[model samples]
Target: MLDANLKSQLKAYLERVTQPIEIVASLDDGAKSQELLGLLRDIQGLSSLITLRDDGTDARKPSFSLNRPGADISLRFAGIPLGHEFTSLVLALLQVGGHPSKESPDTLAQIAALQGNFVFETYFSLSCQNCPDVVQALNLMAVLNPNVKHVAIDGALFQEEVDARQVMAVPSVYLNGEPFGQGRMGVEEILAKVDASASTRQAEKLNAQAPFDVLVIGGGPAGAAAAIYAARKGIRTGVAAERFGGQVLDTLAIENFISVKETEGPKLASALEEHVKQYDVDIMNLQRAEQLIPGRDGALHEVRFAGGASLKAKALIIATGARWREMNVPGEQKYRNHGVAYCPHCDGPLFKGKRVAVIGGGNSGVEAAIDLAGIVSHVTLLEFDSKLRADAVLQRKLGSLPNVTVITEALTTEVTGDGRKVNGLSYKDRQSGDTRHIELEGIFVQIGLLPNSDWLKGAIELSPRGEVMVDARGETDLPGIFAAGDVTTTPYKQIIIAMGEGAKASLAAFDHLIRTSAPE
Candidate 1:
């Protein structure tokens, strides 16, 4: 189950366990059960304080629980926790064994104060990059609060429950036996939903902060760079984002980053956040920007959030970034996370042996088709153009796949589904002007991205496609205001490009601040 190097690492990690822990396994005479037993024995060998038992009685065939003898911590795994979930397993063990967490003190307090009987069941896939955050957060809650108990189940292992619940996506969470959410969610977002007053309290805290010299509106690569640059200038800097990692959190592979040979999106995002924390920048996550109030006659610019809180800054850098472009066809929104998904790498495992469709024939779409062909039974690639727009290498790789079929000049018309989940989709043949429908269990939309500049529409200068228009210095038409990254009119929207743009915008903002005086 674990290799030599992996065993060495696990042994080192288990040394942090301050308390005794028990691993109770519930197994059967199946091959997977035996495999799980082998894994458990390997884990038990790593730590002397850890004991294994086999008198377990879980309904799931191959499952286990990590529990502290006298504590309220109750964490369970329904399948082998490997791949992206491997870190989750390690963190759960450390947390359940009384090791300290890296979460902020405020967040810890929030979890400790939570009241009520909350039972959480999260269905996840091993290949999902977004699942670890959800799983780790919930497991922490279970370890912290006695009222909270979480069971992270592998959706691929338990196909019966997935079909019964019609769970067509990864990180599908259920609270109290009802569907709670179906996407990448962090601790703050989860607390906002479970605790009624969490948002109001957060809004109040944000509203009371002092004004900053530079304020960034996003927390992606651009926002992190801008914040660091501004803070390094010995000025007060602040960053408020809906989520710290932004769209990069949803990305799977990132080989285009110059220095790094190969890396994952979440890993890069974490590094960015950690780098920014070394400075004096005030980092605020899970804050969505709503309205923008430009300063008049050297006044401070104020950015309002959806939570009814606003922050003022001498200069503003808008790096809100972009999100996955959605298919606005009928039934698409209704069946989202039911049968329609955006991140193939995150949700692909849930559709094993199932027929799915990939909309678009670009690099992202074609790449998605190739990746899904291995997990899913068949993949239908549809392109609105006459030919695939992917690179020759990618197109060649996509062509060689036996389980994938490509269609040209096909327009996705509407998503078809029953009341619960998607069943098929309708498309139009551009040449014949005839509509066609294909039955599939899932749909992965990989068209492109849309700029997150909708809120700056009437407040700032924007291009026809909603991208913020900026000059070489990353400054907008309005003085004391700058924009960067994918939200701006940059030629190419790459992560490296975004960071460079963010640094430029921050420096430009600092220059503007030095030249102007704030109104009294």
Candidate 2:
């Protein structure tokens, strides 16, 4: 299944493998398992130092072992390492095969300093490109610290564990059976999380009487930019969110941002956090805003969460972003992070030289098809509308691609996949009244955006589509409140645009604070 060029690349990459690495695949012979076995066999055959062993001597189920040379450190993959998960497999092989870690020496020292028998159980999926980074980071940490143990579980293979933990996101990391974080985390952020998990004071209530000059909600690029701007002005700033990075964490490649030739979502997110931390901003990570309560005395507003934690501020900037709209077709969720993926930039490379289909004919869908066409073997663009809604320029660009086949007025009914991954899509022609099936290895859905403003339903005035309305300065309908990013009435939801809006809102909030005198 490997292309000649890709095969050659893998062969050259594996030449640096100094010691033999053993791969133990104890699969139950499922459809996905067979596919993964073939991939492993191909990889093993390419490298002289690589060995594929099925001793069945290990007592674990659906287990894979990568043993380090001259060390008892053995990293395990308890799932099929396909899709984006392939990166983690390669990282594990190289790490155990005696390759030097890319992490800094100081960072390695800090990791080694963490003395605990903490079991890091990371739930991941193959299609998630971010999960591999987290898994490999933990694997590197384990290699550095003898006390730390890391386990990578394929959430799809272990549905029961995922269900028990109520894991809704990929790359969900649990430190000693408690939620550490989700998504691709930066090294410093993960270290801080590890320290926080070990700290006992996290349960203690923070000072509620402390009022902030400005409070920023949401942690994506917008909120981070907002907090950074507020802090630069020497104001008491606080930014709260479920996790830093917002929807950006779920994205793969981000090349559109000017000056940044190329960057990943997780990397940008971590950098945002790092930049915000450079200032004296009071950041509340893992905080989900529940209710927007009007502030009393000194503070103008207070936001409550499910855990009874509340924060008060003189002004607020709402940056809670939007999420990808799912097609909600059969096998869509079941095969997510398997063969069905939502991120074209993140998971596109995984489907390189493979046939794929894109659902939706809007700008996002067409753009995604265009992006995937350059990486994949062929792209079949299916649109439910009679005519494509994408811009004429985008349509022209998509048309110029010979490998792309555009099908309009196609009503997608189901995503057909074996128990493991998506193999084809079933759709019906709107005018012809004929059903059609297209064989594909991956599917990308780029329907539309659904703003994450449902939580502010009764608290503030929102547009009909649940987008928070804002004026020129990112000021919302309510005074002392502003919004930015995908959650607001911004014509387009772009990172650079959101960051600019966030800075504008923060400056406006500063103006409000200076004029009000109430915070004084």
TM-score per candidate, chains pooled: 0.99, 0.67
For candidate 2, the per-residue lDDT at 343 reads: 72
- Model 1 regions lying over 4 Å from their true place: none
Predicted structure 1: lDDT: 0.94
Model 2 RMSD vs true structure? 8.1
Q: Itemize residue pairs with steric clashes in candidate 1.
A: none
Error of 1 at 246 (Å): 0.7
- Residue-level lDDT of model 2, residues 1-520, one tens digit each, is 5778867877887877887777777766567667667777888888888888765454445677776556666467776776677777777778777777877686777888886677888887665767877888888877677777887988767766665675545777898878887667655557756664422333244334388888898999899999999999998999888778998887667989899999878779879989998999887766677888765454578787644577778898999999888888888988886677777765565566789999889888888999889878999999988899999999999999999999999999999987767889999999999999999988998888899887798889999999998999998877788898889998888999999999999999999888775553
- Considering every candidate listed, which one attains the maximal lDDT? 1
